[model samples]
Target chain A: MGPEVMPLLENRNDIDLVLWQQDCACDRKWFLENVQGATAIIVMFGDKVDSELFEAAGPQLRVVSTMSVGYDHIDVKEISKRKIKLGYTPDVLSDAVADICIMLALMAGRNARESMAVVNEGKWPNYSWAPFLFCGRQLSSTATSQRTVGFIGFGRIAHATLARLIPFGYTHCLYLANPSSAPATARDAALAAQHHLQSVQRVDADTLAATSDVVFVLAPGGAATEHLVGARFLRRMKPTAVLVNASRGTLVDSDALATALRERWIWGAGLDVVTGEPNIAADHPLVKEPRCVVVPHIGSATIETRIDMATLAVNNALAAIAGEAMPASVEF
Target chain B: MGPEVMPLLENRNDIDLVLWQQDCACDRKWFLENVQGATAIIVMFGDKVDSELFEAAGPQLRVVSTMSVGYDHIDVKEISKRKIKLGYTPDVLSDAVADICIMLALMAGRNARESMAVVNEGKWPNYSWAPFLFCGRQLSSTATSQRTVGFIGFGRIAHATLARLIPFGYTHCLYLANPSSAPATARDAALAAQHHLQSVQRVDADTLAATSDVVFVLAPGGAATEHLVGARFLRRMKPTAVLVNASRGTLVDSDALATALRERWIWGAGLDVVTGEPNIAADHPLVKEPRCVVVPHIGSATIETRIDMATLAVNNALAAIAGEAMPASVEF
Candidate 1:
């Protein structure tokens, strides 16, 4: 815990806190031994919150609060079955993640990675300033004509991203929402009018893939969303369009996107996440693709954002232990 | 010339066009041999416009149109003395350069270069996800508190940059305009109201350096502005602050800024231009600084912006040849 969160937890006579203090991942043996008699546990993305861990924690375990927005590491079904309250930090991180999405989009479209490589390789002096050299697509629309921005999932982060793009002249927004969710025409119209955009419409995947100048994948990671942006979707995208994935790596088919870039089917891609993250070697196909600007998952890595997340996680754990509702809790 | 510009010049019965076909710089010998009776010459940054070039054109050169915003390469005094019209592309590139300024600020503050390097080096798997690792300063003001952004030179590009930062919750703006220009109190008040800012004031250089969270150098390159951001100015800046220069390389003392970064005097710096042209070697002090996110001089190297600049340059040359007012002529 940071100094900010330590104040909230320290000198609490009612509760005993046992922190897995090492910077490295908490050893499984250490976790199992120390988790005994604990009423609640605070976890991170690295921890596996499965039935095995729950069995060791005993029936006294009332809550499992994760210091992240994504709970893919947790076994939600088992937690729900036991009626243990679950809390995952969300909304608080939307701004930070949205900021990175814009950065990636600009980096990919502007060829920042390749251009910086030229400077780092000591070849800039020899490279002549040609009229067309190192030129990439513009993020902002210069002309009066509309620029289209599309989203795979119109969630909180997607909405925040759209808000940022408004100033850049992204007049047309097309998003594919959850099929079960009701149409948000009235809301979309209000947003469009507020930002003075041409339109904001809920569209099908095919239309979004074909017409968007920039495509952002902000959908959740699961079997349903796995490989959502595959060969068929890549083939339909505009040749000049940029693809940015700041959400989950599994949403994109890495090999297909790599082929799209290699074959010049798309301008470029900016990705913060990949299918097998941390384990993605330097020789990974996406890493070797010159048109791709890949960064390690750092969507919410800003100092302020991380502290907010940590504080919220601590607050949620404390609330659940007090037999009260968490400020942000999973519906289940 | 690109394929788009070729149509504008090709097959013109009135004017014979001699092309410098190679991607490399035009040979000085070839330039002199062919320039005996040229009415107007379109030049790039690489070509020097001096008394020698004016004499080679043999008193017939009516205009020298550069396809760039900066005319530091042109001898303006000599061009004015010879009564030659000088045209430069300026406003058309402001949006592109402003976009790059924001990119650099975020990149430098967020350690994009260094963090990406970790992934590229295949060391990510070995590194643990610590609470404080890879965290950098936040670009946005998360709470309802104020964040100040300072500008070294408040010009078209500076205003555009300020417009972008408003959405990021920058509540106050401080700028140091040219000393001779009157303080824009009324105009600044109107701007502050329009952007919902606390204030937008014209302040002294020292105050700007001391209070700004992000200081942008958007001044022109000339003897007056040379080394404007050196050790004395840097010493007053907050250690958490970021310095971004997308305008002119000469506005900053590269060695001073590099030392500041190395010694942790400031948070980081993002520079598009350096002291030298295309000659910043790998061993260059600024390039070697880990806190600096350095790129080749590509502030306006977007496909749309470059095309517009080239088209405007061609139009200015044609206009000068026709003895009409050039679209963007510099007054002597």
Candidate 2:
């Protein structure tokens, strides 16, 4: 167990006698010593909480709360068979994530980074004052007429993203969600009324991939959604379109996006989450792409949002240990 | 006089005369020598057009066009007396200038420069994410609510500026034009109604300077408006207010504005036309002020807008030469 999870373990007053493991190593010594005589476990994504770990818990473990949204770190089916509860925070960080989404959208579309580099390099005088020198698209201000704002997934964060776009002159919203979902939920109906939009639908990946002026990737990032916006999707986007990603980075193949931006198939991109965490290198294909804007995974980094998330996670853990209904329990 | 006006000279067939002479020393001398038997004379802001220049051209001088909104440089009294038709391009550049007005409003109110500097300087890592880090007052977008958007003039540009504010959450409009003139002519009443705004009224400079969340100087520049937004007006402005000057340079007292921005008396400011023009030094008082965003006179620099302005200017020159009414003429 690493030191990161040790603090949570020592501070457990309401969550009684739990197993916790942080990734210090990939072998049995760390895992076996960590889960002894525990009723619940808090694991990070790096830890392997498979059948072996579950069997080692000896049927005493009743709840598993991962510190991330994705539960691929744990075997959910086995836990469901054992009737163990599950918990994850989903909508709690929507506002924070939406903030990042907008930040990326504005930064990438406006070419802020490149402009700043020019200012830093003290080349203002050398640059000609041509009308279109750095006049990037101004995301749907009142002064503009046509706009096409798109979403890869119509989820809580995407709804929040739309709220921000309303003020910026976003009139059109195209969505590609799961085909089995209802055609019009209350949120979709409300958004339609608010924006005077045409319709919200679960279109094929190709339609969503093609028509949007600013395509936002807000879909789940797992095996099913991996590389959803690959070479074909990039080809479908307009030459002037911008792509924003605040969801799982795995949904986009970085190489494809980099190629699109470099070849001017797409205008630019803003990404808060990358395919791998903290492993972005100088020579990363996307990093070298001029139109690709990247930020450290700070989607849920706003102070207000982070506090709310922490408070909710603490309350859920306490409620689960006390045998009460968790306020935001995630069902497997 | 300078190379900047070479484009005007090369297209002499289209432009019958030039009006602005502020920097036309060498060029004016050369034009007078090479442009013999010309049908008209062009004057600028600083040069005085009197009976002598008209007499020099004799019967050939048929028109006098000033390259400015104000006719102070033309000696309009003499032009009217001479019965030589006058030409000025007004209303054509209003929307473009108004766009700059709103751009300044947003940039100042949102602290764009400061926020971007923070991000560009790598300060985000050292600072803990906070809720109100760069929050500023959002402009009122709804018309039903009365968040007053005031103006120093009630002309075409001011009306256009109000239209730009509709999407930015601006609801109300108050203006302080020349008290001697009516708030708005009957022609613009319908336009005012479209914005859900009341008729413009004349307010004292102090009162107009005090109440506006964003005060725009869209009035013509010359002796009358010079120092209109001086220290006295700055003293009356709200601490959270933003000031935008796109009409002319001398309307605002640069020293007073710099002091206001530096001392935090006013929130921020955006200036397209600075007082001294190209002579502004790197360490000029206004340039050093962090709260000020100075763009180098790019009011009508948009692709769609500049072509229109140049076309109108060319047409005005031709009309004055052909003894036809200029489509849009500025009067004294």
Candidate 3:
């Protein structure tokens, strides 16, 4: 938690807090034992709030607040049955995550990994200037090539990313939304008008993969969306296109992505999340790929955004303990 | 030159081309000996053009075209005195260079160098989640904290960078220009209106350094402006602020910046150009700083941009040799 959040919880005159003061996440065993007799417990994205956790906390558990937008770690079905109010931070982190999306897109397309290596590994002295050396794909549009940006999911964060791209001269946007939701023509037109884009169209997955100069996987991660950017999608993409994923790890297949880069199916990839993360091997295929730029999941790891998320989580916990509504909450 | 440039020169039956077929820059000794009777000579940024070169070409050098925006490598005064038309690429690369300015800002503020190391160096397995781990400064605005961006020179490239920053929620823009030119309030207001900014104010160097959250050095490089961002200017800056230099290295003193980062006068720096570049030692002070992120001076090194520059340079040479006005020319 942020330094401010601890004081916010401890300074409340009406509340008594059991704080896990370490920098790392609280251990599962420590959480289960210390959570007893608590009215509310604050958790992180790595924690699981399940039947086991509910039984450990007893009937006194009234609220479970998490300092993240997604609650995949928690068992929503069990939490709903127990009627525990779930508080989470969603809108607070859109700008931070969206910022990383552009950073990754620009970095990957600009060959940042290779260029930095030249400077960092002491090869810059020998690697002098050339006209086209170290050149990569251009993100912005020119008269000859108008840029087209595609999204796997079009939510709030995606919208924020699109707004940033408009000034870069991306005139067209093609997105793949959940098929269950109808394509709203009015909303699409409004979005186009708001950003002054040439076109904003809903497209099928294959078309989105083939047409976009840059493809962003911003979909939610779950069983339904697992391996959504697998071989078929990679194969359909333009050879010059770049891929960026500031979203979930499960939505992309590592093996497929590695093959795509190796075979030149796509130009490059900028990934914030990977499958089996937090224990990713040094020799992971995607990690070894020259064209792939990967970072630890730092989509919302800005100082301001992290503090805001922590503050919101603490506030939600305090509000739910007083039987009031959370500042932000999940339906479950 | 790009692959296409060689073909563009070779396919033209009307022109006889002397091509240096190599990946690296042409050797100066070889260039002088072979240019005995050339009407036009195309050069890279590393080449110098002066009286000796004009004498070697036997006064047939009517045009000296360079594949860059900056003509610091060429002797513009002598070229103008000798009635030689000088051609350079300017507007073609503004977008590309502006793209890098934002890239550096995002990379420095978000600690991309550190975060990538966590994954790339195999530290991710043990570097588990913590609230503030790897957290750096935020670039965008929130309801509580609006953003202020500053520039050292408010030219075309600076304006392009400002356009990119608007969507990042920067509300105010402060800038320092050549003091000889009078401030235009009408122009400032017009710029503010065009970008929907809260304010676009002209200020002194110290005020720009002290008030800005991020300061970009975008001025031209020369003796008059050398070391403009020296010790005194760095001292007045916000501790949380970031400094980005994409314009020219002569504008900033590298030693002063090194001390600033070490002593926490500023949070970090992102640099594309450094003083005494292309031969920067491994133990160079700025390169040794953990808070600094540096790349080779590749501001206009995008495939599309470089090709445009090269194409423009070639066309300018051809037109000037034919006694027609060059496509893009420098008056001095």
Model 2 TM: 0.62
Ten residues in a row with the worst lDDT in model 3 chain B? B1-10
Standalone chain B TM-score for every prediction? 0.97, 0.82, 0.96
What is the docking quality class of candidate 1? Answer: medium
Candidate 1's iRMSD: 1.2
Model 2 off-target regions past 4 Å? A1-181, A184-332, B1-34, B40-92, B141-146, B185-193, B197-201
- Model 2, span B161-195: residue lDDT tens: 77656544455667777757755555456656775
Record all residue pairs in model 3 with backbone atoms less than 3 Å apart, i.e. clashing. Answer: none
Residue-level lDDT tens digits of model 1 in B95-157? 788888888888887889988888887877887776667888877777645689999999888
* Model 3 TM: 0.98
The candidate with the higher TM-score, 2 or 3, is: 3
RMSD of each: 1.4, 8.6, 1.4
C-alpha root-mean-square deviation, candidate 1: 1.4
DockQ of candidate 1 (2 decimals): 0.70
Candidate 3 error regions (>4 Å)? none
Cα deviation at B281, candidate 1, in Å, is: 0.9
